[model samples]
Target: MSARPAVRIVVVDDQEVVRAGFAALLDTQPDFTVVGTAADGGEAVLRCREQHPDVVLMDVRMPTMDGIEATRRIRAGADADAAPRILMLTTFDLDEHVYDALVAGAGGFLIKDVTAERLFDAVRVVAAGEALLAPSVTRRLIGEFTRLRPRPPAPELAELTPRETDVLRLVAEGLSNAEIAARLVVGEETVKTHVSRVLRRLGLRDRVQAVVVAYESGLVVPRSDVR
Candidate 1:
């Protein structure tokens, strides 16, 4: 059988040291290839168009165009299924721009202090079209935003089975498949099935978008719900 292809990555950061460091470390991995690097969001967009990489590690802040705007433009130009996945990089887990990045189109984010292993894992996860919804960070940030923003109805949500809705709530709460299974007193595969159904029924591509829908639709709320 043919070996699986290496995941192509483009690292974008204003700092030369950071961009080079990520490229070097990721290149050392057998299944990862650093296809390119960029120092700002404009360059990020240009490189992404030029290389069509599997994933782009986008920095939240930059001089020419911010990551949020770049993410928006990239997503706008590509078919939803074909767009390259984006993993945002931020100095703080709660960086304000990150919330906007998620809304714009990032599949996940990494705090600047992330370990090499976690960073590599995040790239692989997003490249595989999985959502990197890190519980401690993602859920809390979503919750905070939910508390402040006005919830809009997501008409697609009305189509979910009650069980599917429950599963989505748990997912938005940042529970893993196993934890959700344990919480619902069902098998892990059952939880996975439910999660998958939720994604499909809602026309969502992955769990990250599901979480965004849960928040935007007010199906789940901060502090008072999902916990």
Candidate 2:
């Protein structure tokens, strides 16, 4: 396919090599366009406001402004829907503070050593209005948050019907729409409707937040005995 309309992107990293590498890689893709680059979260926020890229490959740690704060500011700013989705970059082996990034309104994350295909795929996923709610990733994030933040109350429980609660449990277990449909013995479209209703009832941004709520609200606990 002739170069599709570019998914405008901004590379935000404190390190020159990282910034250049990301920008160059993304620019090489047919559908991706490198709109700008920034060396810190502060500049990233400013550039985002100015350029309004479709996606932002944000580094977790940077001088002047870290990815967490920049993401928060970008999410909180006027015209947040115009704000690009933030995909945090970090080493997979590192203790990446992913929970903070997600709560800060980042759409997802990518490890620095990821392959070009993986990077592009991640960008596409976030840009397509999907959250990176991988089961293992969500589990790790919930485990970390549970150890740090106080157990938040399930304030929305009263709003959720017993059926909604069941749907949420399946969501926290990482069941996709089809899987949920199959397990619930309902049509896929019906499951989708249920998912939408669940989100609206709980006032969640997306499935990722639903997973976090399931854990933090003590609705779902880490399994002491895995099957």
- Every model's TM-score: 0.85, 0.86
lDDT of 2 by residue, 77-195 (tens): 54434668889887753354667887778877777888999898989877876666653655665655765675767777778888778888888877877888899898988877877
Q: Which stretches of candidate 2 lie over 4 Å from their true place?
A: 1-4, 77-82, 92-96, 223-227
Q: Report the C-alpha lDDT of model 1 over 1-227, residue by residue, as the tens digit.
A: 99899999999999999999989999999999889999999999899899989999999999989999999887775765688899999998777688888878888899888999999888888888777886467777876776677567888888888889999998887777888999999999999899889978887666777887898788877664433
lDDT of each: 0.85, 0.79
Among all windows of 10 consecutive residues in model 1, the one with the lowest summed lDDT is 218-227
lDDT of 2 at 29: 82
RMSD, every candidate, angstroms: 2.9, 2.9
Tell me the lDDT of candidate 2. 0.79
